[model samples]
Target: MPDGGPVIVGISRSTEKIREIVRKVADVDLNVLISGESGVGKELVARSLHYFSSRKKRPFIKVNCAALPGELIETELFGYEKGAFTGADKQKMGKFEAAADGSIFLDEIGEIPMSMQAKLLQVLQDQKFPRIGGHKEIDARARVIAATNRNLEAEILSGNFREDLYFRINTISIVVPPLRERPEDVEPLVYYFLDRLSKEHRLPKPDISPRLMKLLKGYHWPGNVRELENYLKRLLVLGESKELEAELEAAGDGWNSETDTASSQEAVIEEAAKEVLPNKNSREKQFPSLKEVRDKAVYRVERALIKQVLEETNWNRREAAKILKISYRALLYKLKDMNLTPH
Candidate 1:
């Protein structure tokens, strides 16, 4: 590792092991693949690799492969000439060019479309690619670090991903375990978030009650660290432990239950709504009906849970259905009912 310590936070064995691997490979220029669920800080690990390496002084550019549309990904990665496309106003430099002699972090690499996979493979193999509408090949001097929540092996077996490209990027792989799997890091992360949020917001650091801490540790964070951070910020802003407790109680223990049936899921949602929402006419008769409020709460909770499971399964609806213990048709119906579509 470099003079400064690792950028990753946490004292869990899994996190420490990841740091050990990073230290061993930081100086070497081999391509790296990081696999983890969404919001598990894959980008942070990628940054640590670049910062601790010899190329710390150079540019550290990042590209979100999932954010760009399929039609524009190639041009975004390889740049374009002034007259390359319909609206080519001026010369544009892509991520590879901006990251010269440094590192380029490709987040959500599995989302890249099949049409552009071969081009990306060429750049990985040859370290050079021609810009759109330009014959001259540009040298790729940056180290490539790719991360994805998807299982590329399954994708390859299904023919959704290229096998050769998988080998090229899997030179060194790091798997970041989920937060629920490592309970020891929960308290450290809570304090870390509290300190950071307090400093940023210029607020005094509030002490966490043992009860709150216990509930936090007990809950299965489907959204991982990002979700925990958001929840902490909410707690700080609201300054109400009772509200947090009520919501958690309403959410129930179905999150960890392996035998969650349809009726049980519905009952859990109803119980959560009653606990979290105030009864109608409690606030001088300006509130929505109790049924409407319950419906809304149930919708929000269901949407969140479904979305979390989808992310955990890498957007594989069939797999998600199996985990959720719902039929494929029912899952599709619920998605449509909630107006939730995969990005």
Candidate 2:
């Protein structure tokens, strides 16, 4: 937050210490292991490291070890010679080769199969590996950065992750705390996304109401920064052209239509809506869409916002519901109603 270094989000002493560690790690070429939850933006840390390192001008390759098939993990990491396999019609450089004199971020490293761990270990140990079905050796001059959400120590104990590989790639470890632990960041992150979306879409600046901020501050974020970004994206899209007055009206109508049948439900929704939404004229057609399209748009916006917040908050339904100013059960219903992605 000073001297144009980087934006460090979070309040705890541990987070501050971790931020310092990350900044120091980013300044070197040493092996870095970024550990965090799925949506905590480990890749962001990896990118930051590459940018901060001397190798910033060189390649910065990111490989999703978790998504790669176990059969091809070796080839993907170490490259393949021409005709090495049925699909190896041409010579293909592995991530390490592509990242020569650069950085390679092996994401979701914990999901790498045990069979391939030794080969990975060898590359880290020897800085070289033979392309698949080739006799000639390929040097791996790239710096290694690995990320994972899993507990590698537990995996090593379980014989799933190689101890040597673990020790090799984790020369420096940086744990990114989840968003729930950094409530202070929620407000700024929401504003950041709002700004980003505004510029990206060439729309006017968007806003998150004070009531919404209060609601956001009280909620737990299981998914972390990634989730928060997604919600802001949806909010920007939903409110880009609509006045602040419009969103409140829409939320009000949404609350009314969903709960009009039961008097008790109406009271609950009304109370929460009033508490969370800014006071505005409900009679105005500020969003420029009628009942049907507006309702659908709200559903889309709500689903996107809720799912992103959940992802940012680490899928904690309770926390997500609180941010949305709804009950946990109501959030579930909305998610189901919108056919939203679970994670």
Candidate 3:
């Protein structure tokens, strides 16, 4: 992501098609729905739409409905009157009001509860909504741009989502393909992340090795652009260490090992070993010491356990530390050492 511009960085056909859509539909005052796999940059597309729109000067409010409960989401979107809730100390404007005459991006819109969907639909249809516990109705003037990774049509069929609300928000749809579908995008993304992360870390950008680039392009990134970005951040910090290579190989193996046979597993290990090990015919072949092997094994196991605990706790470091029976400071140190950042 460049400094003040939309994060669409690829020149692939799919990416070009997205640019075309943004150019045509932006400023049209029609609601748009962006669909894609997680981390495929759906929010980037939404921002691009908002950026090119007539309301670019106004606030571009973003709401992640999935991050809050149903009751809280309603209050967050429509606001609540002072003293309406137990903690209500002031009458604050909600996201819709904050986005007045601009764009409101509803991320993870599929995760919105069904009951709230009806209220959302009513607001969208009427272009007005009252704050919670208030009789005065405020104009809903924001352009709605919703993004979802789920199959919303399937969700509607299953009665988890309102069909009317889906139709209301999805006047035009933009689907961002996963990175694996557009591998050409990976190169630019790598360079972009490298430059961006290097600047953020205040580190000189290290030259990316051809072998590392090859590994990056060849590996199937199930986590999409976000995953690639995190790996590049790691590279910036770690400078392509053996541990990083092992982690990448392990992640790739796990992704593909669902149907792998015993022989295939051995083949993967052999290939990984070849990458690290000296040529067999070399007279100066060196082997890792017993302590070195032990340390590496411990590091891998610890990293996996810590990662699993972090994910299970939704990356809440304090909760993860409690679950892992480690001190918060210790966990933070491990995370920094392992370059284990949240995705």
Candidate 4:
């Protein structure tokens, strides 16, 4: 991570690549499209771009496109004159005008309605737009950095997103990989979150046992770094608990749970513990060595994660590789080693 900017704490190759891309393009005034799963720190990347850019002194406006209704989007971005609508009472500055020479981040860019997409495209192309119910055109000088979780190419093919608009906002694209694909970054992220969250909450950092740390690194984080941070927050508030250990153990057991399900964490963790944890009652049973257990667990989780990513990408190895943050050749080697194929 660079100084005086959003700190993307990671030693993983993927994190370094993101840092490299930010350094190279931070000063370049081009639209950057950052695509990743929700809570994967897309906004952090956007902020880092703005912080390091030439427009660092100017405003950095953020508009959640998904949060705005279709009817109000146009007026929201370009602003409106007094009495432009029924609720209009006074002159208002639009995001573009307010952004000035800074950057305007359009979060969830794919959710913008088709009608509004054309208008946005025009603004990006012409570098100027008019206020609603006003003739005066304002220059759109802000750098545009858009992010989306949706597959915009699919949206375009389905006639929901404008291809021209896609090209306009996607002059440079950066893909932030999910946490499961970058387990190496887990330790640093855990420490970083612990330190920050402790200071924020005025609590001392709790000692994380090596066993628990191993579980955290091995677990497949469904919510990515956001999920990790939340878990750390709970840890900070509640200290280490058996419940938390069980929940993390479930992820290590190869459960691909969705982030939306609250109960899934408990259910799967309980089930996984029953299956994987050694039973104390079996006196005659010879348990596997710790090394064997760890190797097997890693193999199982890695296979499941790779398969899931590949399936999500519809067997597009290149896309899967990008999402996995591994080189194309490395992904090929892994596929071969793991004996994985398109389902």
Task: Output the better candidate (1/2) by TM-score.
Answer: 1
What digit string (tens of lDDT, one per residue) describes model 3 on residues 1-343?
A: 4557686889899998998999999989999999999999999999989988889888899999999999999999999899888889889789999999999999999999988999999999999988988889999999999999999999999999999999999999999998878988889998888877888899878687787677777677889999999888877887758787777767666665553545554554555455554567989868878777567656765776788778878999999999889999999999999999997
Q: Write the per-residue lDDT of candidate 1 for residues 1-343, one digit (tens) a residue.
A: 3257446778999999999999899879999999999888788799899988999899889999999988788888999988998899898888999899999998989999988898899888999988888888899989989999999999999999999999999899999988888877889999988888988888877778888788888777878889899998988787867878777665546665643455556766666676556666486655678788767887777776798788878889999999889999999999898887878
lDDT per residue as tens, model 2, 28-61: 7689898988787688778778777788789999
The most accurate candidate by TM-score is 4
Candidate with maximal lDDT: 4
Provide TM-scores for the models.
0.73, 0.66, 0.72, 0.74
What RMSD, rounded to one decimal, does every model reach? 16.8, 17.9, 18.3, 16.8
> What does the lDDT read for residue 213 in candidate 1?
83
Report model 3's TM-score to 2 decimal places: 0.72
Error of 1 at 300 (Å): 39
Give the CA lDDT, 0 to 100, for residue 124 in model 4.
Answer: 90
Backbone N/Cα/C clashes per model: 0, 9, 0, 0
Residue by residue across 1-343, what tens digits does model 4's lDDT show?
Answer: 3355679889999999999999999999989999999888899999999998889989999999999999788888999999988888988889999999999999999999989998898889899988998889999999999999999999999999999999999999999999878989999999999998898899999999999999998887779899999999999999879999988887666564454334544454455445565787998877988887677666666666778778878999999999889999999999999999874
The local lDDT score (0 to 100) that residue 184 gets in candidate 4 is 93
User: Which residue runs of candidate 2 sit more than 4 Å off their true CA positions?
Assistant: 1-15, 240-343
- The count of residue-pair clashes in candidate 1 stands at 0
lDDT of every predicted structure (CA atoms): 0.86, 0.75, 0.87, 0.88
